[model samples]
Target: MQPAMRSLSPLTPSDYHAHGVCCCGTPLLQHFHERMMALFAGLHGPETVSASPRGQDSPLLLTNLRLFDGSGAPLRDNVAVRVMEGRIQAILPGDAEPEGAEMIDCGGRVLMPGLIDAHWHTTLAAITQAAAMTADVGYVHLVAAREAERTLMRGVTSVRDVGGPAFALKRAIDEGIVAGPRIFPAGAMISQTSGHGDFRMRHEVPRGATTPLTEQERQGVAAIADGEAEVLRRTREQLMLGASQVKLMAGGGVASTYDPLDSTQFTERELRAGVQAADDWGTYVMVHVYTPRGIQRALRAGVRSIEHGQLADEESVRMMAGEGAWWSLQPFLQDEDSNLYPDAARRESQRQVAEGTVRAYEMAQRFNVNTAWGTDILFNPQNTPNQLRHLAKLTRFYDPLTALAMATGRNGELLSLSGPRNPYPGTLGRIEPGALADLLVVDGDPSQNLDFLADPARHMRLIMKSGRIHKDRL
Candidate 1:
């Protein structure tokens, strides 16, 4: 006699939360539950279908494609990829057929690992700094949700948010409440009083005054800590809230009003406190620093990554290389779309950093330092759409292939520095078997013509993150 077929019921919120933790203790159940919900909603088209009822394991096969693989090696033609259970299962010959898999013909398109942004700020999505400062907290997050979706559609599948209150947004995207990139949130930036992260109005008194904290501080976007004990406390708070890494303001910044670009912030002891706290949590500390002295100080304090070291000298670059620290440099062009600060001093500071970009890249190459790329798009919703264009700017210093690798494999290596605190494990930034299936299919070869990357909506044929198809033009 034939056995009766069993039907499964829809998953409830409580059921999802109960099974949300992965065997590795990663928070992945929510993502699995959401994929199941997407299958039930009939949102995915025939070209992209959920392979299983549980939605955690899906089999997808793409054939007849040119593969870049994100390895910085030569491109291979007529390649095929098999993704199962949210990871790459094999790199097969193009003509080989796989069993029990939904197949998609790539039409000889270019398949590569998805792009990654090493430095991003999810909470600061306003068109201007003033606007970001004045916008309602709830409204800002709403804008962030839209921005995150747009970012993913543009071919970037993951980001390391160096600053902002991104814990909530990260949870939302991870749980499948929204469609967006995977986030490695740094939580609020730990800053010294009157430092780069401080965004208080001119008339407002400093900390310890009768007045309360600034709106940004109150919203957990940035925290001002004065001494070693306070810095340790603030850093621990972010780790407790699930930050994969810690961010500190080791030097002044262009956007900040009170500090000049050349000034260094935070004492050595205070910076060490943050590093120690992050180390205790099985992660590392990345600092926002630019000048040579600032970089040296941060290196001495055990910082593992240096953001925006455009003004660092040769010695500092050598020190960074010797310490095996990551240089998360931004490609700041002096074009019209560049940051236009209203304050004259701030504008000059921005210009100074822009002027140092070429020299920084040169120094990085001279010392053979490990460098990564990021858009560093903040407080400018209008410019956010041009994020990929910033990657093209790297061609000024490197070939198309090398520049693409900087944004992919090199950036992926830096993201893994979080060690045991890394949220989404497995390999990233490459298209090898066993790597996470965050990938893109482009209409043209980005290795030869990077112009296609500037407009992903027009040239990107398919976008997949963790075996789930987000966009499929083919």
Candidate 2:
């Protein structure tokens, strides 16, 4: 009745070689000897080789390392970490041997939590504004993928894209279709008319006029909203499209053409509308603001994150601390070669922001406010490669370990303000029994020599994210 039960044939050496498979259907490289014998037998005499014993699917053990757990604690020597199912399983003594686990000897290296970029932009992968405006969408995504891979390779395991079309990129990385850092994407930035995110050219007419939406707007890179209703609608649209948080332009910026650096962009009511929409979705709003007025308005509107408080005074910093909000500041120094602006007005705005960096950090310290660090490297693909260098610049205001912790633990805390909207739901920026396994193994102690982070390819010996090894020079 079953038509002879369809007797299955055993895999011959030729079959194994053809399918590039080995014992237990593992990849040929995982069972290399069997593959070599199969290939040789196909060419030479009938010499049969037995398959090697298969190891169990066990946890990964990283041994003989110095640990910096990102908790502002002193480094511990001779540490061992075990990772299972993409999460940290246990932390044991380095000398204790584990059974049935894949072991990697860290060679007495410094092991720490991977870096996090609290503010990043995925769509601006091109080096110049003109190139970004003229490049094809598909080509821009290709560049973004390459940049993302580079960012991961440089020891940054996660990033929060403050503004861009990053939803698709985040999905692709999560599905393992691409190799990159974990992304918390904020969909298109909500901007009021003539706001910081408004990228309209000088001669172009306003939206709903004779002209249509620009390429950037149509691509969901930025959305312009005028009134409170429009702001609410736009905010909700971003939330519906899987934004972990909402980004609103509450003040002017150096990169925009229309808005001045001193002027506030959105009204209190408009900002409150965006905040209300984000709150309804169980997330919070982050605003791109610099001045005290902008910061005060956003604080009153329930915004949880304040980006670029470089221009804010001591009062604004104290208010931010009192309100228990986050200060996501970038170390924009005047001597940095990357902060070059295209026009006189933009250059002046950048100078002002750069000059205020020291005071901002001092005020934040004085108030004991929650602070996070990011590169905010925009419109310069060449500068994107220097993300770690930007982190290192924080040593001007903080010690090496404090700077590292700010980029790691403190940034993770800010990202968690999204609440239930957090895409990756686990403790990050720390190495413990329960945190997600995103870590880096470096050749030297970065706390002693911050320059070690400047050259990741040479100094970073191992890179792991989600329990998967991405770079293992060791």
The best candidate in terms of lDDT? 1
Best by TM-score: 1
Tens-place lDDT per residue, model 2, 245-362, is 9999999887777789888988999999999999999999999999999999999999999999799988888899999999999888866545676688888888898889889998
Predicted structure 2: lDDT: 0.81
**Residue pairs with clashing backbones, model 1:** none
**Each model's TM-score?**
0.88, 0.87
Go through the candidates in order and give the C-alpha RMSD of each one to the true structure: 6.8, 9.5
Worst 10-residue stretch by lDDT in candidate 1?
1-10
Candidate 1: list runs displaced more than 4 Å.
Answer: 1-56, 209-211
In TM-score terms, candidate 1 sits at: 0.88
Off by over 4 Å in 2: 1-57, 209-211
Give lDDT tens digits, candidate 1, residues 360-460: 99888889999999988888888898889999888888888888998888888989999999999878899998999998989877667588877877888
